[model samples]
Target: MSSGTAAGRSRSRSRWRAGLGRLAAGTALLTAVALLPWLSGNDPALTVLRARSADQDPSPEQLASVREQLGLDEGPFTHLVHWLGGLPQGDAGTSWVSGEAVLPQVTSAFAVSVTLMLGALVVTVAVAALVSARTLYLGSRRRLHRATGAVGVAVLAALPKFLLASLLATVCGVWLGWFPSSGWEGPASMVLPALALGVPSGAMIGGLLDQSLPAAFNEPWARTWYAYGFAPHHVARHALRRTMAGVLPQLLPTVVALVGGAVAVEKIFNIPGLGRLALDAAIAQDLPTLQTATLALILLGTVAGLLIQVLRRALLGPALRDGALPALHAPAAFRGRSTRWAAVACALALLTLVTAGLLRDPLHVDTAARLVPPSAAHPLGTDALGRDLLARLGHGALRTIGVAVAVTAVCTLTGLLLGMAPQVGAGLTEVMSTMPAVLAGLLTTAVTGPSASGAALAVCLVGWTPYAAQAAALLEQERASGHMLASLSFGAGPGHLLRHHLLPAVLPPVLRNALLRLPTTVLVLASLGFLGLGEQPPTAEWGRLLSENQPYAELAPWTVLCPAGALVLLSVLALSGTDAAAVRSRASVPVRMSRRSRRRGVQGHARPAGSYK
Candidate 1:
């Protein structure tokens, strides 16, 4: 009885500790979010005045009044305290520009976003389920089928969300006339936006399903149930349910990505959701509105993260209690050499295409064949200005890919260097990471004039965080490894350790991180272009083309659809390349042990040159 009581007390203590940890994390997140307005490098009062005054200089009296109204005269902590206190009572303060209450607009926008999110979520779940079911039906023996499906879904996943939105809008609204091109009225308008947002998410879910379903089906219990005369469908369902705890964790990243993707989707569809509103406020430097929206989104994201954690724990409580969760497994694609090669080939082909585009004059306009439809003479049709759609697409592809490559290179290099001494970059990285890439790009474009180089710099500033964080993690792990410790014990200098041991060990993961960030970099580039923060007019950039042809969308649907299609295709190619590189990098890493290598190492007196300290 005494032992049982002690055990109960221990369990209670553990639960209390966990609850406190969660509380601490939540508080930290909220504090950081609240400070975003201060971090944006603009004085709150001045920003409000500028936004309100519409580029005109505000009088000293006007500035003083604005300062008083915003409580800028109060101490920072006191101001933050008041803001936090008001949140629960449904007061989010007032907009800096419009002077209307922030909560109403935020809530109204939140409602629209929630509705859109629900539709997208439903679509993603259904797609994931269907794909999982298809895989199950194909059976584990059908390797070719599974590989093909995986590659296809991965390609689709790689496409930029904005590009997908544009394609859906142009196709459904312009050609079929089934939906409005850019509005959020009626159920029909909702369909295209939902699809645009959902497809990439669906592809992500499908990848998780692909990984989970096969493993679940092959589990001993599943096979036992199969032997007990259960129907294939029933067995599959049982397997899925049993493995759901493992599968569900993957959904968290997908959901987080969807939240970020919503910004571009809302913009493309002209939906006045919180994301679009936030983008507008940020670009215009409407501090109050921007801060309010940013806080709400951060809260939403935090709540989501918490909810996913709770849901996973609830679903797998038995596993947690029993400590039955498995160690992290290698990804399914680790052994796929052909897949990697295929990805490399696709990447090279895309580069070649871009080169051809760079060599031609994409801007050479012909008046006679204006708005011409696809034909042998003028493939992919001509735009309203009678520019060759194919050439413009090629040019856009070159610019898009170039910017993505540049940003990725900068981010990767910066991450590697910073990660080597993580302590130096930790705080700086965290601060920079909070600044949204889209917002930074917009601000840069506004300052430097619309240019791809400016957009790349903006993206580089924010996008480097992930790679840096990953590199730091890898560096720490390498430092802790037995071989690294051995080298240190043998009196290797820091430079020698980094150059000979740490660098090689960290390369694989860094390469993989770079590959993974490519699609997102492209997405940021495209989003900036979509917002008119990319290369100036007639540059033939994909997002720019989408914007330029919107007015003529009704007259020449092909003008919009063609560039949109090209964007999707280019994204597909980029993703395929990423997958391929990931596979090759994973394959290049030595397995924990290989029998033949053990003998070679034992037999040879001399260590190979490549095996330097």
Candidate 2:
């Protein structure tokens, strides 16, 4: 009626349909959250009885009594209904561990996590601004400056949040006596935890700004201001504000990453945040606590997603224009020669650590100096059994990195093969993404009987989805590109196109995808190890170290602290490799802009359409 094209009307209808689909999906997810107690695969009566009996086996008569007393033997819906009824009163349920109200514990933990999150966010934004400002001043033609900045970002981004936390705990708290090692006592205590969590977050946000801000300052309006006798600093100030606007959409991913990274941070710092509570519940298989924690996280993620969407709409106007969403372009890679050197240096350092570890006999035990604190003679201290902590840590790194690399390799291959058929891969990826990594890992461990190989296989099972999805998305874009079409027009066959174009474009993103997935794979492996579902002792897996040394925590705190520090280090080293890869990818490829972006020129908004954080 308003002279809109048919395509525009069709797209509008499609968007509405998509909205409805999302709404239904959200409803189903909420339902699953509410019913998680029933889906935990353990009998409520048995769980309760196990807790009550401690290590003792309860009798059949006792089991029946417990079942009836708890009304678990009643209709399944009855319990869910009762739980739902209590929701209005804010009663989530009782914690199986403490036999106390779940809501209060959750509230207290949530408060702690919120405080940490707020602190991290503040650090992230402030650091991002400063980094961006610094980048603006580093004259555009200076390759050395760019390379230095890239390497710095690569190192920071490469370190896992947990590793950063452990280093802070050790160097600042234990060694330097600058802060308390682990506690939630007061404001001073929060500083180290905040830095541990915030620094890596800031690095990521800063990298985004570093990449976007320079392009923004090169726009025509900024140039016009310069031409009109505006000082370079004033033009840069305006450009920075514009750059912030363009990068606003990236906050969604940052939030998701923050939440995931918090789990390890909370554990290391001994903060009783929601992440720590979730870990406890998972290890204990405390159904009520686990389900409640899961629900809380899901709710938090949902709210964050909603808020991001609202903010995007307000800041960027309608998501779709001319009956289609705007096309997105990858950031152009920085053309610094030193980026490759930085990546090589990272690889060589990690290889050296692993090789040194392998050459040493880490398993040799000296009972004489058991539980020895760190000294010049034996660095990283000795464990309770007097095993060299440094050696075990080195061997552990070898095992952890081996598993991560193997998993990543398999995933990358699978993703590449699957990506060849985008339509098929996309649906399969969606289904796979929905499956829980923990659940899959548990199943795999059960079938294979808990070996390191089984753990790696399990992680691969769930981890491949992300790379696979990214592959499909990237390939689909490549297939639609003008060059690919032009090749087809010249009578290029599928094989020719595959050989000439598709593989080249897809390879870079796939490699970057593998790097991105590394941290998560490490986290999963460690978690499984902690649960006794990963590599057993003598293997020196970091997670197993946590479980094994827990009792020795009071007797020999170093036993626990050392392995944790090693894990953090290994994770950091692994992550830095990814950052280097990203730099290489950005530098090598010609970043193709959408037609819309080209037309808009300097004044046009160059916001990316969408991203999976």
- Write one digit per residue (lDDT tens) for candidate 2, span 151-213: 565455545456567768877988899988888998777888888777766765676567555
The CA lDDT at 529 in model 2 is 70
Q: What is candidate 1's lDDT per residue for 1-613, written digit by digit as tens?
A: 9977887897677456545544454455445444545555656677777777665777788878888887766745675677668888988777767989988988888778778877887878877766566666754332322243555665666656765677678778778898887878877777888888777777756655564455455444455655666667676555455445444544543554455447877877888887778787876556556667666655565455456547755654553443333211223343345555655666676566566556656888889989999887776688888888778877777666677778889888887787566445633443344445665665566556667888888787667755665555445444544444545665668886665556655665456446544665666676677677776676777767766776676678788776555545554454455445544543443342233235434211112221211
Model-by-model lDDT, in order? Answer: 0.62, 0.59
Model 2 alpha-carbon miss at residue 63, Å: 2.5
Clashing pairs in 1: none
Question: How much lDDT does candidate 1 score?
Answer: 0.62
Residue pairs in collision within model 2 = 158-575, 158-576, 163-568, 253-613, 333-586, 333-587
| Ten-residue region with minimum lDDT total, candidate 2 | 319-328
Best by lDDT: 1
